[model samples]
Target chain A: MTSNQDHLPTGQPDDGAPRGKVIVSVDAMGSDQGPSVVVAGCARSARSDSDLGFLLHGDSAVLEPLVARQPALTGRCTIVHADETVTMDDKPSHVMRHGKKTSMWSTIGALKSGQAHAAVSCGNTGALMAVSMIQLRRMEGVNRPAIACLWPARGKHGFNTMLDVGADIKAEAEDLLAYAIMGVTYFRNGFGEERPRVGLLNVGTEEHKGRAEIKEAHELIADHAEIGRYEFVGFVEGSDIPSDRVDVIVTDGFTGNIALKTGEGTAKLVADFLRESLKSSALALLGAMLAKGALGKLTARIDPRRVNGGVFLGLNGTVVKSHGSADATGVAAAIGLAAKLAQSGYHGRMAERLVIAAQAVQNAADASAQNGDRS
Target chain B: MTSNQDHLPTGQPDDGAPRGKVIVSVDAMGSDQGPSVVVAGCARSARSDSDLGFLLHGDSAVLEPLVARQPALTGRCTIVHADETVTMDDKPSHVMRHGKKTSMWSTIGALKSGQAHAAVSCGNTGALMAVSMIQLRRMEGVNRPAIACLWPARGKHGFNTMLDVGADIKAEAEDLLAYAIMGVTYFRNGFGEERPRVGLLNVGTEEHKGRAEIKEAHELIADHAEIGRYEFVGFVEGSDIPSDRVDVIVTDGFTGNIALKTGEGTAKLVADFLRESLKSSALALLGAMLAKGALGKLTARIDPRRVNGGVFLGLNGTVVKSHGSADATGVAAAIGLAAKLAQSGYHGRMAERLVIAAQAVQNAADASAQNGDRS
Candidate 1:
C-alpha cells in the first residue's frame, strides 16, 4: 500500500538547522463522529497555535477535501495516506499483529520515526495502547505503562492527575510507585507545577487500611518522594480524588478505571438532573433563561470536552487517547494537550525523573534488606 | 452502672405471651450530634410505626432526659445502661477487646442474645463491624460477611443495592459469590423486588476484562443464578451502578467503597457548583428564587439522608449502620430500615438463600474438578 503520499515532507529541517516548530501526528479517522471532527479540531488547533504543524494520517483523498475547507490548516498540514482504520471492536492483540497499515498505527509510527513530536488519536483505546507499546516501547525499568488523565478537582489548578486509568488490570507495588512518579512528572510538565503532592488511593486514609500492595506502594512512594521531586501526602480516600489536598493520585488500573468511569457517570447524571429541574415548569424555564450566562459558565467549567485526552505515560513517545465519541471541540482539546506536552519536552523530562526515582527505590530496598540480615 | 433502666420493660409481652412488636436495638451515644439526635430519631420512627419498639443502649441519665423531651418515644422505649461509648477514634481491635460495656457493643449484644430483632448504630464503622462480626458471627459456610447499602440509581425503585462497601478490603471468588447472594437477597427483602438482577462490578462489561477473581466470581454467580433466585447480568461497569440495568452490583469492599465515596464526592461537587451559579448575580439569584420549588424537589430526590442505612449481611442477625455524622433524619432512616428488615424476617430468609447458593457453588467446583480428572 506504499504510495507517493508516504514520501511526504517529514517537517524536519535538513541541513543541520535548529527545529523551530512542534509537529503533532494526527489520526484523522476512526473517531465515532468520523474524520470531519478530527479535521475541524486540527483546524481549530492551527488557528490558535501558529507554530504548530500536523502530519495528518489517513486516506489523503478524504482528508484533503476536509483540510481544503480550512485555509489555516492547509499549509501547516502534511497528509500521509493509510489504507485502513482501526475499528473500536478490534482486539489489542489483533491490532498488534496486523494493524501496521491502519491510520492509528501510522500515527504512532510518526512519533517512533521522529517525524512528529507526539501523537493524538480519537480511536479504540486498547488498539492505540497496543500499537504504541509495540512501536514506541516502554521506558527503562518501567514494567507497565500507565494512562494519566487530568481530573477536575477542587484544587488551585482546578485539576489533579491520576494514572493507571486502564493500562493494565493489576499493578504491583513497584508498578504503583512507577505510576506515582509518572503522575507527578506529568502534572509538573503538563500543568507547570514545580512539585506536585502525590496521594495513594485507598479505602481509608489510615495507615492500616486497604490491600497489602497499597500499603507497600504507599511507603515506596513516600521513600522516593525527595528524589522524585514530589511530596507524599500519605493515603487518600476516593473522596479526596477531587479534593484540593493532593495533585496526583496513584492506584492500580482496576480501581482507577472504575473511579474514572464512575466520576464521569455521576457528573452526567447530576447535569441531567439539573437540566430536568430547570425545565420542569414555565417559571423554572423562564428563570433558566435569565440565569443562562452564569449557568453556562458552570457548565463550561465541568465540561468533559474541555479536558478530553488521556496521556499514555512511561513510553518512548507521547500518545494521547481521546474519547472515541468526542466532538470537534473535544478533539481540539486533545490536540492542544498533545502539542503542549510536546512543546514542554514532557516525555524526555518524565523519563529522567522516573530513572532517578527508580534508583532511589532500589537503594532503599537494599538498605532494608541489609538491616533485616543484621537483625 | 446498673440502674432502674436495667429493669425496665424489654417490650416483650407480659404474662409469658409471644412478642408482636419488632424491637430495634439503638446505640444512643457516639453520634457526632450526640444522644439527643438518637432519641429524636427514635421518636420519629416510633411515631410512624406503632408496632416498632426500641432497646435504647446508653447512659440512662443522659438518654432519659432526651427521651422525656420526646413524649412520643416514652411508652415505646426501654433504656439499657452502658457505661462506655465507642469513640470514633478507637481502633477496631481495641473495640473488639475492651469495648464490652460500650453503648455500641451493648446495642449489638441485644441482637446476639435475641432480646431485639435487629440492631441499628450510628457509631464508628470499623468498631461496629468488628463488634458485629464477633457478636453475631458469620452464617454457616460463609467465609466473610458483607455490608450492603442501597445506592441512589435511575432504576425502577430509584435505587440499586451494592455490597462489601468496606466490610473488608479483599474478597476471594467465594467471598464475591457470597456477596452476590447477600446483595440479591437484601434488595429483594428491602425493596420488595421479587427477583433482583445481579451484576458483578468491573472496569468493563466485557467477559474477559478485570481481575482473575472477578472472572471466576462471574462464572460462579452465573452458574448458581437459578438456585440463588436472581438473574446474573454477567458483568457491569461502574456507570451501571447508578443505572437501571441491574438491581444488585456485587464487588469487593475496596472497589465498592471507592465507587460509593467517589459518587458522593462528585454529587456534592456538582451541587456546590450549581448553588454557586444560582447565587452568582442578582439576576441568577432572582431566577433561582423563581425556580426554588423545582430545585427543592430535585435536591430531595438525590438527598443521601433519605436512604441512609448500610445493612450488614451474611451474619446471624441484621444490623443497620447509619452514617456517623447522620442527623436526626438520617438516624430515623436507619431505624426505619432495621424495622423493615426485622419485620420481613430478612436474616432468616437471607441465611437460607446463602446456604443453598454456597452449596451450589461448591457443587460447581466439584463438578469442574471431576471433569478435569476425567479429561
Candidate 2:
C-alpha cells in the first residue's frame, strides 16, 4: 500500500506549506475498531487545523490505503512501517522487552527523537504507559509519573483535572506534592487557567483527617502553592471532584483510579436509567420526543466522548492515551488535545514550574528541621 | 413540655398489647431537623408495624411535646430523659470522657443493658461510633468494627451492602477477612439471602493488582468462603459496586468512603442537570409535566432517603446511624432497618459466623505453613 505519489487533494488551501507546523505521532493500529478509525480521526483533525502534520506509525500496507480515502490527510500524512503490533493483553514488562518493532513503540519513539511534538495512541494502557516511561524518561527531579485526565465539571472551563488515575498504586508524601505541582501546571497550560486551585483528595475536608502521608502532603502542598502560582484548597473530599470548588484534585494512583472508574460507572447507570424511564410508558415516549432537543444538549455536555484522552504528565514528552474502544470521534478528541498541549509548549513550562515547586517543598522541610533543633 | 397524661388515640386497635415486641433505642436529638422529625418517623414506623416499640432517649421537655402530636406512638413509646446532646463538631474522645449524660450515650446504653434490641442515632458519626465501641465493646476476636451502608444497585434486593464506609481509615488483612465474614452475615440476615456473593474492592479485577494487604486478604477470603457460607468473587473494581455481579463489596474505610461520596456526588450532579434542562424551555417544561408520573417513579427508585441508614457491623449489639440531615422520611427508613435487624437477631448470629470464619482462616494459614516446611 506504499504510495509512489505523495501529493493528493488538500482540503485546505494553505496545507501545502509545512513551515513551523506541529507534528503529532499517531499509532494507527491496535484500536478495538482498527486503523480506519485512527485515519478518520487524523483526517478530521487535519481538516480543522492547517498547521498540524502527522507521522502515522503502523503497517504502511494497511494504513496507506486508509489514509488515501481522506483527501484532507493526503498531503499531511507520512506512514512509517512497523512489522509487529501490541495486543491489549500483552504485559507491560513483556512489551518493554520485545516491543521495539511495534507501532506503539515507534509512535512514542518519534516524540522521544524530536520528530513529533506529541504522541497519541489507543492501545494497551499498561503497555503504552510502560513504553512512554522507558522511552520518554521522567523529567529531572520527578520521582513518579502521573496520568492526568480532564473530568467534566461545573467549573468555568467545563472541566477539572485529576491526576495519578492509574500510573502507580503507591505515592509517598513527596510524590503527592509532586502530583500537586504537576496537576496545577498541566491544568494551567492545557486549559489556560492562570491560577488553578489545587485540592488534595481525602476522606474528609478537615486537615487532621485521612492517612498520615496525606496530611503531610497537605501541609507540603499548602506551603509550595504560593511559589507554584496556584491556590491550595486545604483538603477536598470525593464529592468535590465534579464540583466547581477546585480546578485540580490530587491523589495517589489507587484512590484516583477507583474514583475515576466509579464516576464513569455512575454516569452510565444514570444514562441507562433515563433510557429505561423514557421507554416505560406510551405517554413517557411521546414526552421524550417532545423534549429530545433539550435532553440532547444535556447529553452532549456530559458525554464521555467529548473529553476522551488521559494525558501522561511528568514525562519529558507528552503522550495522550485514548480509550481502546474509542471510535473516530473519540480518537479525534484525543488528537485535538495532544495538538493543544503541543502548541502550548506544556512540557517545557511544566518542567520549569516543577523545579521551583520541588525547591520550595525542600526549603520548608529544612526550615522545620532547624526550628526543631533550636527548640 | 413534659406531659402528665399517658393516654392518646391509638392508630391501631391492638397497640396497647405488647407481647413479643422488638424495641429499638433511638437518640431523639442532634438531627439537623430536630426531634420533631424523629418523633414523626417513629410514629410512622409504629403505624406500619405493631410489633415494634421505641425507647426514646432525650430531654423529655423537648421530646414529649413532639411525641404527643403523634397519637400512633403514644402508649408504645417510653421516654428516658438525658440532659446532654452530642454536637456535630464534638470530638469523639471528648464525648467518651464527658458524654455520659448525652442522649447518644444513653441510647447505646439501653442496648448494652438489654433494654432494647438495637440502637438508632442521627448524631455525630465519630461520637456515635466511639460511644458504641465503648458501651457495647467489639465482639470477641474482632479487631475493628465497620460501618456498612446499603448502596443502590441492580441486585435482586435493589441494594448491595458495602462495609467500612467511614469507621476507620485503615484495615489489616485480618481486619479485611473479618469484614468479609461480617458483611456476609449482615447481608444474609438483613436481606434474607441464604448465600451472598462477596467481592474485594480494588482498582482492578486482576489478581495481581492492588496493595499487598488486599492480595493477602483475597487469598484468605477465598479459603474461608465455604465455612462462611458466601461465594468469593475475587477482586472487583469500583464499577462493580453498582452492578449486579456482587452483593457485598469490602474495602478499607478510606477507599470505601471516597467511593460512597463520589457516587452520591455524581448522582446529585445528573439529577441537577436533568432539572436544569427541564426548566430550560417552555416545551421541555410541558413535556416534563406530561411525564411527571414516570419521572417521579425513577426519582423514588434512586432516592437516597429511601436507604438512609448505615449499620455499624462487627459490634456486640446492632446500631443504625442515620444521615445527620435526614428528614422524617429518612428517619423512618432508618427506624425500619433497625427494626428489621433487631427482629432477625442479627447480632448473635453474626458472632457465631465470625468465630467459624476466623477459625477457618487460621487453619488455612497453618496448612500453608506446614506445606511450606515440607517443601
Candidate 3:
C-alpha cells in the first residue's frame, strides 16, 4: 500500500527552528470512527509542523474524501493505500499475524522498516503492544515494556509522568525497576526534568508495606547507580498523582490502569457533581460563584484531554497509544506527544542507563555470591 | 482467662430494642502499636455498647491497666489471659504452626468454638485470612472465600457492600460470581436492603470490554438465579462508589482495593486541597466563608472516619477488619457495626441463600455437561 507517488506534492518550507524530518505512520482506519478522525488529526499535526510528514495507511477511497475536506493537508500528507483495518475487538494474535495488511500493523511496520520515525494509533492497546513487540522488540537490558502517560498536577500546568498503565498485567520487582527507569527518562526528556523524583505506588508511604514486588523493587532501585540519578522518593499512593508530590510515579500495569481510570472517572464525577450542586438552587448558585475561580482552575489544570495519550516504553521505537475514544484533538495531541518523544532521545538514554544498572547489579550479586552473602 | 464470672453482668435494661448479647473476640496484641490502641478501642466499644462483651486475649497483666481505666468495660469485658502475641512481620505459615498460645490465635479460636459471635482485629490481613480460612472455614457450598466491606455512600447513613477486598488477588469469572452473590447477600442482610443492585467495575460500561475474567463473569452473573434477584446493572467505573450508582459494586480483590483506596485518597486530597486553599490568603478566607456550609456538608458526607471499617465476608462467621490506623471513635463505630451484623443474623442468612444459589448453578452446569450442550 505504498502507492504515494500520485498523492505526493511539494513539501512545506522549513521554519526557523530546524525541525527534524520525522515520518509518523498513522493507522488511518484503526479508531472507532475509522480513518476520518485520524486523517483530520494527522492533517492538523502536519500543518502545524513542517518537518513532520504523515504516511497515512488505510483504504485510499476512505482517505480521499477526508483529504478532500482538508485542502491544506492535500500536499502535506502521503496516502499509503492499504485495504485492511484492525478492529478493536480482534484478538492480539490475529493482529500480530495479519498486521502487515491492516493499517495499524502496517504503521508499526513502517517504524520498524525505517519508513517512519514513529507510529501512532488509537486502536486496541493489546494489539498495538503485541504488534510493536513483534516488529520493534524491546530495548537493550529491558525485560518488560510499559505504557507511560503524563498526569497533570498542581503547579503551573503541573504534571507528573507515570508508567506501566497496561503493558504487563502481572509484574515482578525487576519489572517495576524497569518502569521506574523508563518513566524517569520519559519525564526527563519529554518534559525537560533534570532529575525526576520517582515514587513507587503503594498502599502507604511505609517501606515495608505494599505488594512483595514493590518492596524488593524499592531496594533494587535504591542500589542501582543509573536509577540513583532519579531521586527515588520511596513510596507514594494514588492520591499523590495530582498533588505534585513527585515527578514520576511507578507501578505495575494492573494498579496503574485502575488508578488512571479511577482518576479519570472521579474527575468527571466531581465535575458533574459540582455542576449539579451549582444549579440545584439559588443559594447554591450564589455559593458556587465563590468557588467558580478555584474550581475552574483545578479542573482546567487537571484536564485529562490535555495529556490524552500514553507512550509505550521499552520498545525499539516510539509508538504512542491514544485513548480508544479519543477525538480529533486528543489524537492530534497524541501525535504531538509521539513527535516530542521521537526528538527527545528519551528511550535511547533510558536503554543505555538500564544496561549500566543491570550490569552493576549483576556484578554486585556475583561478588556477593563469592563472599557467600546471598541474603 | 474466661474465669471472671462476675464480670458478665448483663443488666443494662430497657432501651426498647432487644439488647444484643454479642461476644467479640479481640486479638489484643497484633497491630503495629501492639495492644495499646486495640485495648483502648475495645474499652471504648464496651462503654458505648453496654450489652457488648469481649474475650480480650492477651497478657492479662499488660491489658489490666488499660481495662482498668474503663470502669464500665471491666464489668462486661473479660481478659482471655494468653501471654503470646503474633508479630506482624512473622510469616503466615510460621504463625499458623506456632500460633496456638498467641492472642491472635486464641481470639479466633474463641469464635470458632462459639464462645464469641464474631472476631475483630487490626492485625496482618494475610495472617487473619489464613487463620480464618483454617479455623472458621468457608460456609457450606462456597468454593472460595472472599473478604467484603461496606463503603459509605451519600444519601442515607448506609453503606454499599463490596467484596474480595484482599482475599483472592487473581480471580476467575466464577470466583467473581461467588463474590457477587456474597456481596449482595451481605448488603441485603447486613445493610438491610431487600434486593441490592450489583454493578461490576470495568473501564467502561460497554458489553465487550474489561480483562477476560470480568467479561466472562458478566455473562455468568446475568444468567445466575441468585444474581438475577438483584438489579444487575451492567457496568460501573470506580467513581460510582461514592455517588449513588449501585448498592453493591463487584470486582476482583486487587481492583476493588485500588478503587476503594483511590476513592479514599481522592477524598482526603480534595478535602486537604480545599482546606489549604482556604487558609492561603484573606481573599480566599472570604471565599471559604461564602462556601463554608456546602463545603462542610460535603466534607461530612465524604469523611472516611464515618465508614472506617469493612466486613470480611464469606467466612463461616462474622469478622470485621477496621482500618489499621483507625482512631477510638472509628473502632467504636466498627464495633457497633459488628454488633448490628450479629443482631441481624447477616452471616447465617447470607450463607443459607448462597447454598441454594450455588446448588442451582452447579446443577445447571452438570445438566449442561451431561447433555454435551457446549453452546
Candidate 4:
C-alpha cells in the first residue's frame, strides 16, 4: 500500500507537510490484543498523517479476517504475512536467533533495510530491545538503549521528557550522562526545544547526597563544556517532576520504569477515587453534577491514553514503545508519536548530538591528564 | 521528664513508670533544619507518648539555646553532645571516620550500645544507612538491607507493606525471595496480618514477563514451603499496588524507590489538580461544598504523612526512617511505629521467619534437583 500524503502532527491536524516522509512499521501481532487493535490504531494513524505507511507483520490467517472487517483500513495499511509470532514469554536470546523470521524481528529488519523509518511495538519490551540492538546495532556512541516518556507538567510549558524507563537496570553514572544527552536531543527535536534543561533525579537536591555514580556523573555533566548549550540543572527530587521546573528528567532504567508505572497507577487510582467519592451521597451527586464538566475535562487531560506513547531513545533507529496494556486509543497515540518523531528526525538529531557528547567526554579526560602532567 | 497522662493509645494509662519504653536517639544536627525541628518533633512525641525517651545527639551549644526557649521540651528530651555533624555532602567512607563526634554517627552508636532501641533520622539517608550497617549490623539471614514502607492501598486494609525502597539496587533473584519473606514477617509483626499474600512487582501479571531475576524469584517463592504458607500470588504490576490485591509487594530497591516517589508525587499532583478543578466555577464550588466532608476524609486517609515512616527491615535492631521532609506529626507517627516494633520484638520475629524461609528454599531446591535427576 502506498500513500503520498507527507507528514501530519501527532494528535492535532496537519499544519504543514514535514520535510522527510518516513514509513513506520507497526508489529500488529506484538501487543496483547493481537492485530485488530493495532490495525485499527495503524488505520487511524495513517489517516491523520500523509507521510505514514504501515507494514503489518502477523499471521495472515488471523490478520486478514480483522483487516477484512475494516475495508477502509485495507488500502492505507499493508499486511505482510509472517507465520512466526514472538510470545511474551519467549527468551530474548531465542528471538534474536531467527533475525528474519518472527514478526517482531522482521519489523526491526524493515527499519534496518530502510523499509520503515521507525518500528513501533507493544510487544515483549525485552525481545524488542534485544532484536533492535542486534538487528540495527547501537549507534556509534550509545552504550545502551533508553526508553523516554513525555510527562505532562502542571503549568502550560508542556510535557517534560524522562528516560531509561526500562532498558538498562544497572546504569553507571556515565550512562546517566548519555541518557541526559539523548533525552535533551529528543526534547529538542520532538518538542522543538533548542536548549532543554536536564535535571538528574535524586533523593535530594544536594549534588553529593546520592550514590557514588550519581555524584561522579554530576561532576562530569556540570563541568563538561560541550553540554553548555543544554541547561544543566542540579538534582531534582521526585516531587519536582510534576512541576515545570525542568524539561528533561534523567535516571536509570529501573527507577524510570517504576516512576512511569507508579505515575500511571496513581493516576488511575485518583480517577477512580474521584468517581467513587462523587457518587457516594445525594448531595455529593448534586455537587458532581455541578462540577461534572470540569471534572470530565480534567480527567481527559490527565488520562494515560492522551499521553500513551514513549520513544526508546539512544537506539540505532527510532523505536517507540507503547504501554503493553494499552488499548486502541493508547496504541493510536503511540503511532502518532512515532509518526511525529520520524517526521521530526528525532533519532537522527539525537544520534548526531550523542557522537559529539561522547567525544567531549573523551576530550575532557585527555585535558585532565594533560593538566595533571603539567602540574 | 515524666508526665502521667493518657495521651496516646497504649496498654495502660500513664502510671509515671516507663514500662516497655523505647528510647530513640535522634541526630538533631543531621537534617536540613537542624536541631530546632528535630527537638520540636521530639517534644511533641514525648508529650504524646510518655513511655518514650530521647537522647538527642548534636552540639550542646547550638541545641542549648533552642532548648532554653522551650522549658516544656527541656525536661522531656535530654541532649547528648556530639560536637560535629555529618553534612549531607560527607563521604560515606569518611562518615564513620569522625563517628565519635558527629551527631549522626553518635545517634547510631546509641542504638549499638543499647541506650536506644532504635535510631530515627531525617538526615542523609545514605550516611545513616552506612552508619547503621556499621553499627547495628544486618539481621541474621539477611544478605542485604531493605527499606520497607507501608504503601496505601485502596479499600483500606490498613496499608500494604513493600520494600527495598532505596537500598540493595543490584539485587539477585534469591535476594528478592529473601525480601518477600522479610516483608511477610514485617507485615505480620508490624500490622499483625495473618498470611499476607506476597507479590513480586513486574511489568505484567504473567509469571515469565519480567527479567530473569524476577522469573527465578517467582519460581523460588512459589516452591518454598514457608513462603507458600504466605500465599505466593505470583507477579503483580504497578496498578495492583493501589488495589489491595496483595498485602505485601516486593521488588529491588531501585524500582521500589521509583514506585515510592511516583506514588508520592502523583498523590500530591492529583490532590492539587482536584483542588484546582474544584475552584473553576461557582457550581463546582457548590458541589465541592456538598461533598466537602467526604472529600476531606478521603484526602486525610490517603495523606502520605499518616504512613510517613519506613522501617529499615533487615537491621538487627528496629530502625525506622522518617521522610527527610517530614513535619512534626510525621516524625511522631514514626516514633509510635518504632515504639510498637520494639515492644513487639519485631526484629527477632523477622529473624526467626527468615531462617525458616531460607531452609524452605533450600529444601525446595533439593526436591527440585531430585525430580530433575529422575526426569
Candidate 5:
C-alpha cells in the first residue's frame, strides 16, 4: 500500500467502501459463528471494494480452508495463526493475565505492529476492550476510552453518534467534557457532520434536572462548544436521541449502555407486537403480503445487523467490536466501519482535536483556581 | 363513602372503572387541553361506571357548561370552584410558596380532607409533587415519594410497574429499596400478580455491574424481598424492562425517567418509520387501507394515551399524574388507575408493607454498623 492510497476519500464512497488499500485485522476465532462466518464477512466486505484487505487471526488449520473457499478473499486476506481463542465466558482480567496468545490479542497486535490500519472482532466485549487497552493503549490526554455506536435517528446522515456505551461505568463532569469533545469529532468524521450538534443526556431537557455531575458537565460542554467545534444543544432527554434535534449524544457508560439496550429492546418489542397484530386475521395477513417490500424496508431499517459495530473511541488505534452473535452481514458492517475510519485517518485528527481541547480545559481550570484564590 | 367501598375489588374489573362509589378529585383547569377536555374525560369515565364520582376542582364558571354538556358527568361530578389555575411555566417552588389557591392545590386538598379517595391532575409534575408532598405528606416510613408508571410489557398482566420516573433525581440505596418495596406492592395490587418479581435496573445483568449505589441497593432489595412480599430477580439490564422475567423495575428518578422516555421515543420512531414505509408506494397504501383495523390495534397497543398515568407512590394519600397534554381518553385512563388504587386501598396496603420492610432495613443497617465498629 502506497502513501497515496491513504489520501483516498472515504466519506463519499463510490463502491460503498473507501477507494484505498485498507486492511482490517479480524479475530476470526472469537465469533460465535466461528472462522467461516468471519472469513465470509471479510469476503463480503472485500467483494464490494477490491482495495479492501484483511489479516485474519485464528488457527490456520481452521481459517485456511475457510478463506480459500471465498473467491473474493483468495488473495485479499492473510491468515495469522493463533492457537487460542477467547470464549464468551472469558473474564477480562483472566484474559489479560493469561490469554496473550488468543486470537483477539493477536488481532489487536496486528494494529500495534502496523500490519493493519484497523481491527475488527466479534468477541467478548470486556476481553476485547482489555486486550486493546493493554496493547493499543488510550490516546494521549484521554482519561478513559469510550465506545461509540451509531443510533438510527431523524437526521440527514441517517444516524446519531452516541458515546460511552458500556466503556466505563462512571463519568464525572470532566470525563463527560472529554466524551463531548471526542463524540463531537467522532460524529464529524464518521457522519461528515461538520460542527455536529452535541447534547448532554439527562432526565429532562430542563437545566435544573439530573445529578450534580450532569449539571457540571452541561456547563463545561456548553462553555467549550466553540473549541470542541460543535453546537451545544444543552441538556436533552432520552426522547431527543432519535429526534433530529441533535447529532451527538454523550452520557456516562452506565446510562449510555442502558439507553442503547432500552432503545433496541423497545424497537424489538414494537416490531414483535406489530407482527402479531398483522397475523391476527386473514385480511391483515394478505395486506402484510401485499406490502411485503415496504414492510421489509421497515424491518431492514430497524434491523440490529444493519448497524452491527460499536467503535472504540479515545483509543490510540481504531477497533470496531462486532456483535459476537453477528452473522456475515453484521461482521461485514463492522469491517466497513473500521475501513472507513482507517482510510479517513480518524486517529490522527481525533488526537489533534483532543490535544487542543485539553489545553482549553487546562486554561479553564487555571482561571477557576485563580478566581477561587481571589475569593 | 362507606369503609366497605374501600375494600371493594378494583382488580378484574367487570366494568372499566372501580366497582364501588369512589370519588376522584380532578384538577379541571390543569390540563393543556383546558377544562373542556377534563370535563369530557370525567364524563367518559362516568359513562362507563355509574359507581364512580368526581370532585372537579377549578373555576366552576369555566367547568360548569362543559360538564353540563356531558350528561354522564351531570350528577356524578361536583364542581369545586377555584379562582387560579397552575400554568405549565409555574415553578414548583413558586407554586408551593404563593400559588396555594391554584386548582392543583385544591385538588390535592380533597385527598387530605378525605373528600376524595384519590387525586388526578394533568398539571406541571413538579408542582403536583410539591403540593402532594406538602399537603398529604410522605408515608410513615417513606424517605421520599416516587411516581410509579405502568410500562407495556410481555406479561400476563400486560404491563410492568416502573417507579421513580422524575419524582426526584437522587435515590440512594435505601431509597431504591423503598422503591422496590413500593413497586412490588403496586404491581401485585394493580396487576394481580402474586409475589411480583422485582429487578434493579443497571447497565448489565451481572451482580458486579453499575455504580456502588446500585450494587448496595441490589443487596438491600434482595435482603428485604421476603418482608416486602416480592421475589428478588437480582440486577436486570435495560432490555429486561419489558421482559416477562421481571414485573417490577426499581431505579432512581433520573435513570428511570430517561429509560421511560427512551423506550417511548424508540417505539414512536419505529411507528413513524413504519407509517412512512406503508405510504411509500400505491400498493403499500392499498395494503395499509386493507390492514387498517390491524394497524389500529397495533397503534392502540403502543399508544401513549392508553397508559397515560404515573401513580405517585410513598405518599400518605394517593395521586395519579396524567400527562398535561392528555386528551379525553388519556385522562380517562388516569382516572381508571386512580379509581383502581382508591378501591383497592393501595395506600394502606402499601404503607403496611413498607412498615415491615422498614424494620428489616433497620435490622440490616444495625448489623452492618456493628460489623463496621468491630472491623
Candidate 6:
C-alpha cells in the first residue's frame, strides 16, 4: 500500500475546486466489479462536477494505476490506501470484531474524521451498518439507524422517499416516528422538495387497519407534522408508494425490505416475460427492431442502477450503499447522490430536526400513557 | 325480490351436464360493472364449458333479461333474487349485522345450504369476508380465516400460492404454521403439484433476522414439514417470492397484503412508463404495430383478469372474491377458479389438513414450555 504522503492534502485545490466542495469517501474494494469500476465512476463524477472530489480507499498497489488512467481524476482524488477488504459473505459481527484494516472501514473513517463530507460503499449492508454504528455511532436521540431509498414513482421529483428498507427488522412506535422525521429530511435534501408529504405504510388506508405499532405511529407522526415540516397523509397502502398521493413512505424494516424486493422482482419478471414474448415470432422481431429506441427509453427510466443508492440515516454522517454488482454507471449514480447530500449540508440540519422530532414523540407517549391510565 | 321458486332447483339436469358438475353461486350485483357483466361472464363460462352452471343472486328484473340474452344459458341458469346490495363503502361489521338481505349474503347462503358447490363474489372484500364468516362459520381448529392468492411467477405451474393476503393482518406463530399447511394444500389441489416447496416470508434469509413471531413460525413450520406433505425451505426474502425456489409463501396478512399491492403497483408503473415511451416517436409507433401480436401475447400472460379470484381459506365452504371492477372475462376466470376448487373437494380436505396442523403446533408449544420449566 502507498503511504499517506503519496496523496495531496485536503483543500489543496488540485482540481481548481474550492475548500467548500463536497468530497465523497469511497470504498473502492469488495464490490463484484472490483476497484476499476469504482475509479471509473469517480472519474465520471469528477468530469461532470468540478466542485466534487473523491477520497478513494483501497489497496494503492491496485488503485494507483487505475486512477492515473483517468485524466478527469488526475488532480481530483486522494487515495487513502488500506491493507484489507471486506468480502460480501463476511458476517457483520466478524467484521465488526476484526475489520479495521479493510477499505470499507477506512472509507467510513474518512467521514468520521471529517476528511470527507459523505461516504459511499458497495459492501455488504449489515457489515457497513455495524461499522458505522460502532465507529460514528447513532445521532443524538436516535435508537436505531435506518436506510432510505428513492422509489421511482409519479411525482414532481420522479421518486418517492422510503426508509428502513433493511437497517433492522423491528421498529416500535417511537422508532417509526423518528423515521418519519428522518425520511422527510432526506426527501427535502436529496430531491429538493420543500415540505414533502409523508405517509405511514400499512395494509389498508383506514385508521383501524394494521398492527398496533402502526396505529401508534400514525398518531405520533400526525401529531408532530407541523414540527417535522411535512404534511401527514395518515396512512397509505402499498399501491400508494408509487402514486402521486405522497412523496415519502415510512415503514418498519421488515415490511419495507420485502416491499422493495417484491417491487424489483415484479419488474424483472415483467421484463423477462416481455423479452420472451417479443422473440416468439418474426413479426415481433421486426417490431422490436423498429421500437428499439422507444424500448430503450423505457428501460432507462426503470433501470434500478439509475437510482442506485440507499442512504443510511439516523447516523452521525451520511453513508450511501450501492449495489454490490453495480458497474461504472451505477457506482457513478450513487456517488452523485452522496455528493448532492453533502453539498446541501444535510448532516448538520438532520441532527437539529431529529432532536425536535424526539421531543415531540416523547410528549405524545406521555399523553398516551396518561390516557391509558385514565381508561 | 322474486320468490325462490323463480330459480331452478339444484341437480335438475340444467346445462345438459350430470349431477357431479361444479356449480358456482355468484353474487351478480354490487360489482363496478353491475349485474350485466356478471351474467355475461357466466354465459361465457357456460359456452366454453358445457358442464358449468350458475346460481346467480341479484335483482331479478336486471338479471333475467341479461341471462335470457345469452343462448348458452337457455337451461343452465337459476336466479335467486336479492333486493339489497352491499356497497364498497359499507362497514364489515355493519354488513355482518344487517346484511342478510344483501346479494353477497345470499351468495354465501348458497354455499352454506349446499345449494351451490362453491361461491364467488365481486362485492367489497370486507363485506364479502364478513358475510361468508357469519354464514358458513370457520372450519374446526381454525383460528383466523385467510385469503389465499395465486401470485404470477416463474415455475412449473407459472404461479405461486400466497396466503393471509387480507383476511386478517395479525398472524401468530401457530397461525403462520396453519397458513403453510393451507397454502401447500391449496397449491396441490389447485395446480396439482404433488409436493410444493414452502417458505416463510421474512426480512432476510438469516435465522436470526425478523420479528419474534417469524422466528417461532420458522421453527414450527420446519419441525412439521413431513406431516405437512411439503418441503420446508425455511425463510425466504422478498425477491424469492417470484423465484423458482419456493412454490408457496406464507406470511401475516399485513405483510402479504402490502407485498401483493406493491408488486401490482410496480408492474403498473412499468407498463405505464413503457406505454408513454412507445408513443413518444413515429418509428416506435410503427414498431409497436409490427410487434402488436407479440405484445398482446405478453399482456395476456400477465393480465390480472386471467387470475382474478382471491380464495377465502379455512372456511367450512369455499368462497372466491373476484375483483370489484372486473369485466366479463375477469369474472369468467374467477368462476373457473372457484369451479376447479369445488370439483377437487378442497373444502373437506382443507379442514382435515388444518386439524392435523393445529395438533403439530400444539405439540411443539408443549415441548418448548417443558424446556422453559427446566430452565
For TM-score, the strongest prediction is 5
How does each model score on TM-score?
Answer: 0.92, 0.91, 0.79, 0.85, 0.93, 0.90
Worst 10 residues of 2 chain B by lDDT: B1-10
Docking outcome class, model 4: acceptable
Q: By lDDT, is 4 or 6 better?
A: 6
Over the stretch A232-329, how does candidate 2's per-residue lDDT look in tens digits?
98899889999999999999999998888888888777777887888899998888887887788678777777778888999998799998888887
In model 5, residue pairs whose N, Cα or C atoms come closer than 3 Å (at least 3 residues apart or on different chains), thus clashing, are none
Per-residue accuracy of model 3 over B26-66 as CA lDDT, tens digit each: 77776566677877777777766677898888899998888
Q: What is the interface RMSD of each candidate, in Å?
A: 1.2, 1.2, 3.6, 2.2, 1.1, 1.2
lDDT of 1 at B39: 89
lDDT of each: 0.84, 0.84, 0.72, 0.75, 0.85, 0.84
lDDT of 4 at A17: 24
lDDT of 2 at B128: 95
How close to the true structure is residue B79 of candidate 1, measured as C-alpha lDDT?
A: 98
lDDT of 3 at A198: 84
Candidate that would win on lDDT: 5
Model 4 DockQ (Cα-based) = 0.44
Model 6 TM-score is: 0.90
lDDT, candidate 5, equals 0.85
Writing each residue's lDDT as its tens digit, candidate 1 over A212-318 gives 89989988888888878889999998888888999999999889988888888888878888898888999998888888887887887678887788989999987
lDDT of 6 by residue, A1-375 (tens): 012111101112223322467889999995898899999988877877788889999999999999999999988899999999998778789889999999999999999998898899999888999999998899986998999988889886778878889998879988898898888877776666779899999977878667899998998889888878899998998888888999889998888999999988888888888889889999999989999999998887778887888989999887999988888877888887777666656666778888988887777679989999999
